[model samples]
Target: MPEVVVITGGSRGIGRATALRFARRKGIRLALVARDETALAAAADACRARGAEVLTVSADLAAPDGPERAADAVVARFGRIDVWVASASVFSYGSVLDTPDEIVDRVIQTNLTGHMRAARAVLPHFHARGGGTLVFVGSLFSQIPGPYVAPYVAAKHGLLGFTRALRQEMLGHRGIHVRIVLPASIDTPIYERAANVTGRTPFPLPPVVSADRVARAVVRAARGGRAEVAVGAAQLVTRPLRFLAPRVFDRFIWTLQRTLGLRHRPAADTTGAVLAPMHDPGAVSGGWSRVPLRHPRSRRR
Candidate 1:
């Protein structure tokens, strides 16, 4: 029997790339879940052409019963789920006081609670089967702090703790594993689609890693690997900086976010993909690699 994989947020980004990678291997079946139907269809078709059985579920993971329904649908089609990837998350930018309540709630609901719901939906099956692998696609923000993205950072921190707890709980099951991949500034469409009310346009920082690279990490975790895998070389340095020199880390990260993360270019206040899906959900890569990273100075300055 082929291995069954259920991936959330499969419409684009790391999830889509992971699906394609798994499709390349023999004896694998994929079920892609996300809100964008058109993009999901495109991703599913691509995976099918790669010769892997594919099932696309167009559902929002933030919804109350969305994960449960998706899990049911996957089991109905694939019989069993061997791997579950929790990558369905939304992004937003603004200080806590500056961002609206609903936006923050949505980000937490989708990024943190959404993953929790997925665990609830799948753990029972894993327990029954005596084994399964659960991978959570987190961010470097899970440990290090950055300015203007407090809500996202908070959600990731919570996600990391939750994953740790799950891993501890699954210790008894020999075949069960809980893994988390923390990538720093991946070139995903998240920056373009994220809700921004800070007036300044946001962009991924220097050395933006490719989404496929992050996907490969996820693939390794699913197969068998370390419990925690942090992508990007900078992640290694940042982790220690947080402990060795807390003040220096704070000032350095804040300066970098101000100078490199957000552009001085003014952006009108409009919720981008916060309350709903993106208008044009682009492909896996956000093309940030082509654009050189520079200190975006204001014309007035």
Candidate 2:
């Protein structure tokens, strides 16, 4: 039997890259879930070109029944699901006070609650099979929350807590594996799709890594069943610094937020793609590679 994997938010970004990565292995089956039907079909076609079977399900993960439905669709097409990647998320860019309540609620619903629902929907099948892997695509913000993205930060933090609790709960289920992949700023379409109230275009912080880097980490965790893996040099460096020199790290983060995270150009306060499906179904890269990298101090200057 081929290994069957279900990836939420698999239409683009890290999820899309991860799908392509898995497709490299012959005979693997992929079930991709996301809101855009056209995008999902396109992703499935790409995976099919890689010698893997693909199933695309168009569903809004934010809806209460959405995750369950996606899970059901996967099980129907493929007898067993060996891996479940919770990568569906929405980005919100604004201070807590400035962001609308609806945007905040949507972020929590899609990022946190949706994953929880996905876990619930898959755990039974995993237990029945006697073993399976759960991979959660989190962010470095889960540790050191960034400024101007209050809702996104909150959702990621909640997701980390939820992953920890789930890991503990699955302790006795010998074969069940729960893993979390935290990546630093990567080149993804999330910035373009984010709800921005920050008065300027949102972009990933310095030293932006490729989405393929994060995708590789996700695949490695699935194969190895690692408890948690943080991708990117920036993410790995900040982890220890945040623990050793708390005050210094706090100051550094604040400086980066004030200088590099936000821009002064005027931007219409639209909700971006959070509330609706994107018409374009963007490619893997967000064109961040063209943006010159700048350090915190340089940004301040």
Candidate 3:
């Protein structure tokens, strides 16, 4: 039987790249899940073009039953799931007080709770099958925080903890694997789809990499490479800065936020994709300059 993979948020960014990566291989089946039907179709078409069997599930991970429904939909079609890459997430750009309660809640729901829900939805199948992999695409923000985007950072921090705890619990199921890929900001539609209440435009912290970079890491982890994989060199640099010089870390982060993270021009406040999905089916890249250059967005009306 072919390897059956369920990828949440597979229509865009790291998830999209990961899907295509897997599609290039032989005997791979992909289930692409996201809120946009158009986007899912677009992604599935791309994967199919690459020679992988594709199923697109249009579902929102933030909804209470969303993850379960998506999993059920995939299982109904594929019969079994070999790997679950929980990569569906949304971004919000604003200070804690500036961001509305709903937006904050939605970000946590999508980024953190969604991953947890995905695990709940799929682990039973893993136990039944006697082996499977769960790969959560996390962020460097999960380890080191910056100003603005508080909800994303907090949720990712929670995701890191969730991964650790889940890994410990999976000890009984020797064939069950839990992994996290913590990449420094990679180019993705997330910034473009983020809800931005802050006047300044949101951009990724510098040293931006392609979504393919993270996709590669996701692929490796899914194939039982490592429990925790950090994608960018900056992901390595940030940790020591946080631990060795806490005060310097704070100043450095603030400076980066002020200069690079936020663009010079002011942006309109819109709840980009928090309340809903973007109109575009989306793509593998955010249209940002690749690594060795960089930047990082909002809610829509």
What order do candidates take by TM-score, descending? 3, 1, 2
TM-score of 2: 0.94
Q: How far off is residue 227 in model 2, in Å?
A: 0.7
Alpha-carbon deviation at 242 in model 3, angstroms? 0.2
Q: What C-alpha lDDT does candidate 2 achieve relative to the native structure? A: 0.87
Q: How far is candidate 1 from the true structure (C-alpha RMSD, Å)?
A: 2.7
* Per-model CA lDDT versus the true structure: 0.87, 0.87, 0.89
Candidate 1 off by > 4 Å: 279-281, 294-301
lDDT of 2 by residue, 88-166 (tens): 9889888888999999999999999999999999999998989999999999988876677878889899999999999
TM-score of each: 0.95, 0.94, 0.96
Cα RMSD to the true fold for all candidates: 2.7, 3.4, 2.8
lDDT per residue for candidate 3 within 18-102, as digits (tens), equals 9999999898999999998888889999999999999889899999999999999988999989999999989999988999999
Q: What is candidate 3's local distance difference test score? A: 0.89
